[model samples]
Target chain A: MNKNFIILGGGQAAVYAAREIRKNDKESNIKILSEENFLPYERPPLSKDFLLNKKNQEDLFFHSSDVLKNENIDFENISINKVDFENKKLFTKNDDFYSYDSLLISTGSENKKLSLDNNLNDDIYYLRNLEEAKTIKEKVSNKNKITIIGGGFIGLEIASSLSQLQKKVTVIEIGSQLMGRIIPKQIADLVQKTHIQYGNEIILNKQINKIIKKNGIYEILLNDNSLIETDFLIAGIGSAPSVKLFEHTNLKLDNGIVTNEFCETSIKDVYAAGDVSNFYHPLYERTIRLESYQHAQNHGICAGKNIAGVKTEYTSIPWMWSDQFNLNLQLTGICDDYDEIIERGNDINNGVIYFFLKNKNIRGACGLGIAGKVGRDIRITSKLTEKNIIVDKQILADQNQKLNKLIQK
Target chain B: MSEENWIEVGSTDSIEEEDLIRFDHQDKTFCVYRLTDGFYATDGICTHEAVHLEDGLVMDDEIECPMHQGIFNIKSGEALSPPACEDLKTYPVKVDNDKIFIKID
Candidate 1:
């Protein structure tokens, strides 16, 4: 008898894992349960292209309905209510029970809500998935003054995009600089400068105390005893793992559902990936949960292979990208534990590439405004091994030096 | 006279091994780099944005975009990274009597 694989959640992780499982196990019965009633689509474009109406929903879809039907994969748009790990069965909210030989939880994440009084009206928005993006785009047309509650990547990108649409965008960040969690202070200032140059206003170190809606307009009260009137409000606070379904299960939960390198949870024959899984990183030497597209896809790939009886570990380098205005940003590896930063290129005129060096080894890199112009045929090894190689910041700034030469010695 | 395509832009000794040089020929910018194996040529401008690839660092057989760290294959002109989906154009170059001649057409 062929084994049956049941994957919960219908985001990128679930979709990619299902594809990889089918690739290795052709005869295995694969079923996916998604809470949302749509096909697996790329969520990265929700803020960039899709929100701007540059691309439609069809373009963001990763696997079409036809592909799902052709593969004989059963996809149900129902939310799961409970998971019985010992019995290997899942109970959905629609009163459906699914028995699986193996199960994968890819239930991505949900937007973090704000702690505010009930005075705010319906004009406030929090962007997470496609539905919220569509609603924001629809409401943005008539909105004049838009106050973004967070200065993270999503908030900054939305500000950039809406400012291009001629909306008065103001970003309220509790931190001193934008994107301070991911980028350095200097680079964050540059990103802030880019937003400012485009006529967007950023209010730093200001906490939103309260929001009062009156007369079709919202008055935002800040912690600094100031008030600002806005037509609409957008909250890009953060995201938390969607692990409510697993509340009754025996799955180990840390910041997220704890999983090993193989994406296996504490329960036998059960796995988790994407934003819901707190996976152990070999490079970082700790369990970390990433909410980016790359981590979700990689987790899905690893979980799929393991479910198909192929033993593989998830050890790919962690990388992410963000497009705000015309500035294209890409980051590779981890930079949280780095001691020093090696800056390359002209920060003001050309672009900038930052190397996070730890004990003379390159551990991570962040590039701004230079993604499209770079070559694509180079192999990026773990920066751990590149420590022995000698590289000068001046030589790296030179446009003529080939990257391959830096790795040869 | 085919517009005399052969122009002595630089001498072989002008560039050392693993060094890249930017040259302007016929109002077009070309970045010339000497590999351990051979010499390679590509567009002076990066395909992603305005950052100059001639200012980028070359490693293995590719050059890291100085601006965004996007990697490109020096030999094939393929973008090996994101943000840059387009490939750079490669030109043919030959060394005759210590002078470097690049084929424009």
Candidate 2:
């Protein structure tokens, strides 16, 4: 019944939704408003491939610009300034008003630029999109000393990538551990060790006090009274949801735009997906705002199917991965709020396995590699965690027993 | 190079613990998977990105990409989950006793 479907933000969510909508309803006009000039591209490669020079600009794009023409989808490189819910339309920065029968708010998150007390703040860079990655790539060349702020996924990924290019990397984290919010502390410590093993300095439990430029270099003072000099600074402190357009609108907002299981926002005839959605996940039985490729793709498909009159619910399990050098760190389900943490392998090197147990069941797991078998184990136990199946704690902690056999009911 | 389309990758013992082994024939790479049930073969690289499937981990008949956790069905070379969209090219597996062979076009 909805003919004109307008999607805001031109990331993975918008692209996937456009594809799904086109597959179901051919006659509906699909328009995507993207702030970036480039086509929808893969964000993961920005810190990995784009930095390593393994992937070029063409490789970054998910589809060619002609894809819009071929797929009969309307894509415009324009920023959406405001949403007019009263008129069922949205206003662009160019003063263009777009009316839609149905709207999808896929506007992803933006990099939270650190508000530092220094005039040399302009010298620091943050990698969120292709443009910023390109800028960092240009700046990183022939530059030896690099000070990275924050120890999150983005910060760490960029750290490992820059260190691969043989730059003296120093990662400064305010937290005592890396990836503290997601993985367990033991795993975070192992990651820090791995970085140190790779000849990168990791200074934790401290942050920048202030910064200034001295003789074409950045001299950063830390809260611990220590000093660091670097060619430049790259801060991946964190990200905030791109919900600025919803200030005047009646759309419910929290960490992000709130959505139901069907990826439908509180507002009727409007939906939300991707990183910008704080969706009520069926598995977790709570509202979650996930920033991952899997959720974006699945949520987009679910929202598109719902928009096309299909009653599809997004129920995919949340999983995340990080590649540091030869190590593969993978986690399935949430690790927080577990009653006990069962650890196997050496927590220092060759990886360790942390089975987050609650109620005598493996609710989730994190695998770090000194050996490369944790990912497979996570896959075996992920179903158990999702289904809330009770597992023998001893069997789970035992490395000799096959996880696949233990999981068999 | 061998008799007909079947080319011996090595013995069945060569693949240890469900590790995906990459075998090359002509100009294409095929990932030979050893599962608890049986042997399977598919395109070596991930359908999502240009990454070797052998670099990923294999559980049962599913291969998870190392770059992203995109899974692929080893028996049919079907892209089972996201980040992955296109189905991989599946090749027939013919295990001759201890020696295993893959049939690729």
DockQ, each predicted model = 0.16, 0.27
TM-score of each: 0.81, 0.89
lDDT of 2 by residue, A1-409 (tens): 5489999999999988998889898888999989988789889889987899988888777677787788899899888787888689888777889999999989999999888765666888999899999999998997999999999898999999999999999999999789877878888887888899999999999978889787898888999789999997999988888998896689999999999999888789999999999999787789888888777888888888888778898877777787777677888777886898887666424346798887787767888874344666777767787777887777777777656554443
User: Pairing residues by index, what is the TM-score of model 1?
Assistant: 0.81
Which structure among the candidates has the greatest lDDT?
A: 2
Deviating ranges (above 4 Å) for candidate 2: A347-351, A370-372, A405-409, B1-39, B43-62, B73-92, B97-99, B103-105
lDDT of 1 by residue, A199-243 (tens): 999999999887888888888889989999999889998888988
Report the lDDT tens digits of candidate 1 across residue range B22-51: 888777888887888877788888875566
**TM-score of B-chain for each predicted structure, in order:** 0.89, 0.90
Error of 1 at A402 (Å): 3.5
